[model samples]
Target: MADYEERVKLVKEQLRLAIYFAREFMDVLGKEKALEIIEKAWIKYGADNWKGRLQGVPPEDILKVMGEWFKAQEKVRSELKVVEATPERLSIEFTRCPQYDVCQEMGVPEICQKYCDSDYGAATLINPKLKMIRDKELAYGADLCNHCWVMEE
Candidate 1:
């Protein structure tokens, strides 16, 4: 939908700004502080964003809802492979990431690590009964990013 496209654009813009700010911060403060600030900010944002997106959605259906969103995202932009999806589990492999795309475009590719780390906090907010595991990320020069979510007892 057009709305989703707009949302994608907005996310891209936000990422660009974040990378710019991180560069600026690194120049003034240092790499450690810059990474810290960006990671902290995005973690908080991810938690809040996923919390709001999952609001009113039941635990059993959270992955379903997210799966639809994820599928839509692949359609809109980004190269994503849906590895598996079920009520109890979901997995996706991302070969192309918008953040990585932005980083490459801006020549600040390392910023993707800070952005990718937000998924950890976001997963916590999604559901305490759910566990999210990501072993590799494109930002870290991995061939692909694998995200797996499982429902826990």
Candidate 2:
């Protein structure tokens, strides 16, 4: 298990990435729109659905899909930033991530949108990582399922 300090450092890094993406994502879709879509993704598909889909597919699929989807949105958003008269709305596939559900539950996604709580200790980080437990709720947090594949960077 990593010490608390290390965990804090990593979380800081992840949050930084989250903020960067959140801004870029919001630049395309306003903050309100982006938050709405991300919340929807967290609701529709999560660890419950994750289990069934992953049964047949290799674990690597998660990382591959997540990374690719993020890249795709990044490209589109970057282009819009460079060009003028852009739509002023981002069409990023918030649901396209192979693991947005997973990220949301874990509270590590680019946005602060709450999720279905299915994404707890589900990640298999090399070191033990802190979880995002609700202050007054314990509805959906579950220990990291060992079965899940590593998430894409």
**lDDT of each model, Cα atoms only?**
0.79, 0.40
Model 2 residue 96 lDDT score: 24
TM-scores of all predicted structures: 0.82, 0.32
Per-residue lDDT of 43 in model 2: 44
Cα-based RMSD of candidate 2: 17.9
Worst 10-residue lDDT window, candidate 2: 81-90
The residue-by-residue lDDT of candidate 2 on 59-119, one tens digit each, is: 4454444344445545643211111111121122221222334345455554543443334
Clashing pairs in 1: none
Q: In model 2, which residue pairs have backbone atoms overlapping below 3 Å?
A: 28-89, 28-90, 29-90, 121-144, 122-144
Best by TM-score: 1
Model 1 residue 73 CA deviation (Å) reads: 3.1
